[model samples]
Target chain A: MSASLKSLPSNPAFTLPQSNDVQGTTSASGPHIPAEFEQTLTLLTSHRSVLGYLLLSRSQPVSIIRHSGVVFEGEQGRKYAHAVGRIVETVQAGLEEVAGESTDTDEIRFMRIRTKRHEIMISPDERFLLAVLHDPTS
Target chain B: MSASLKSLPSNPAFTLPQSNDVQGTTSASGPHIPAEFEQTLTLLTSHRSVLGYLLLSRSQPVSIIRHSGVVFEGEQGRKYAHAVGRIVETVQAGLEEVAGESTDTDEIRFMRIRTKRHEIMISPDERFLLAVLHDPTS
Candidate 1:
């Protein structure tokens, strides 16, 4: 696993030094917010599954701002329970088929499998994940 | 100056495992592009000034991209010029007025100031800044 990992070449890996930091000020009175932030937010917001995964993993409700600039806050986990639950249900069914019983052992195994899938989806965009976690109420 | 820098907290940094090297056999398969590549392109495309700074410091162009989706290609010098230009036009403008010199040297400095500003505003986001020894554009 260690052999497969590639390192990021840049200094200050995730933290971007904005114009304000470079100029040593609270804000740089520029004509516009840098396009990068806008693009990043767009990418993050575009993926609904990522948002759903976040809310589920954090075990917290979240608000998603639509592309039209309207914000919608809700318990995404509860709302998407059917789809996600179906996935969980399917996994449970598979385990029962193999093990011939829905024992305590099967429940634990199913939970681990579900958790692993959720983790795999959420692992890649850690910065966006942090941003969502750190989002101030709005 | 270095003493003013704050140290990061003792939390272990998260590491993402890379499954493949550059141009690896792993094919892209997902609802979205691989997060690693998405981040690299996003960082490169978005933070032109930072890229410029890196390029300037290195004095040579570099190219990077992996099967994971990160792609960057550019010279450091050009990026530096753009960053310097942005700094001059935006942050350094106030400083220039404070200095208040209208000599030929001052005019040359002012022209340099304007050129950097213009380069950042007008250039394509993906285009690399090329450093010219005598001419600002060679």
Candidate 2:
């Protein structure tokens, strides 16, 4: 019951793993997922893992879950995921403008397109995507 | 001489040379006297000459100039340059928050910084440093 976990609202759609279960693998009981869906799920799972590492290193109580094809929360507290998502979106849009695209006025500006060399990773719960926006200029 | 030229407003003291004058070499009696100043002046001058070529090809007005011994402007117009400076500052702040040091925010955040390379020949008039802000992401 860390402060961050206490801050997030409980999401019944996804189960909250105990502190020890945070690193457990996903069950292989589900149907064979499409490659695209699997890729997206892997990205989300990776993102959750990274975030989990960050939070755990900070001794924060926040936990992330990727399920139901989307990343969600299991804590019974306040969630700052929306804020983090917005920040990611802002960075993506800035990258697009630098790329000479006119995405300043569009919400799709934040959506990172899949590329051969670069990609976004998701978790098993499908709660988040580890989106890596590369700056081709450098 | 125009009033702006006489007083030389320090904010954007540099000006773009006339199209015809963009090819001439710096005069022996140029205003910058010190060797370091002369070298910088030479660099700035050369930039102007290169910009002329780009302007001709792209049909776009691009210029660069030093201001107050600290600031430098790159291509993309007045508003865009200022916006870039602001974005640089913002990214610098964000990086500091994440990394705890003043890293090269320009390199990490925008593809425009890559265009800052590419040496150019200078013109006589110490007005502008013309270079392309090529979209690196493209």
Cα lDDT of model 1 by residue, A14-110, tens digit: 1222434333322354223245545544554554333323222211232222212111133332333222233333333433343344253232111
lDDT of each residue in B24-137, candidate 1, tens digit only? 242455122245434443443333232221212111232212211111123333333433334323322322332246332211111111121121211111212112111113
lDDT tens readout by residue for model 2, B1-138: 344322321112122343344344446654223344334435433432223212111112322333311112333244343333333333333333433243532212111221122211112222333222221122
Q: Estimate each model's TM-score.
A: 0.18, 0.27
What pairs collide in candidate 1?
B37-B69, B37-B70, B52-B79, B52-B80, B55-B76, B55-B77, B56-B76, B56-B77
In Å, residue B101's CA in model 2 sits off its true spot by 9.4
Lowest lDDT block of 10, candidate 2 chain A: A50-59
Displacement of residue B6 (Cα, Å) in model 1 is 32
Q: Lowest summed-lDDT stretch of 10 residues in model 1 chain A?
A: A108-117
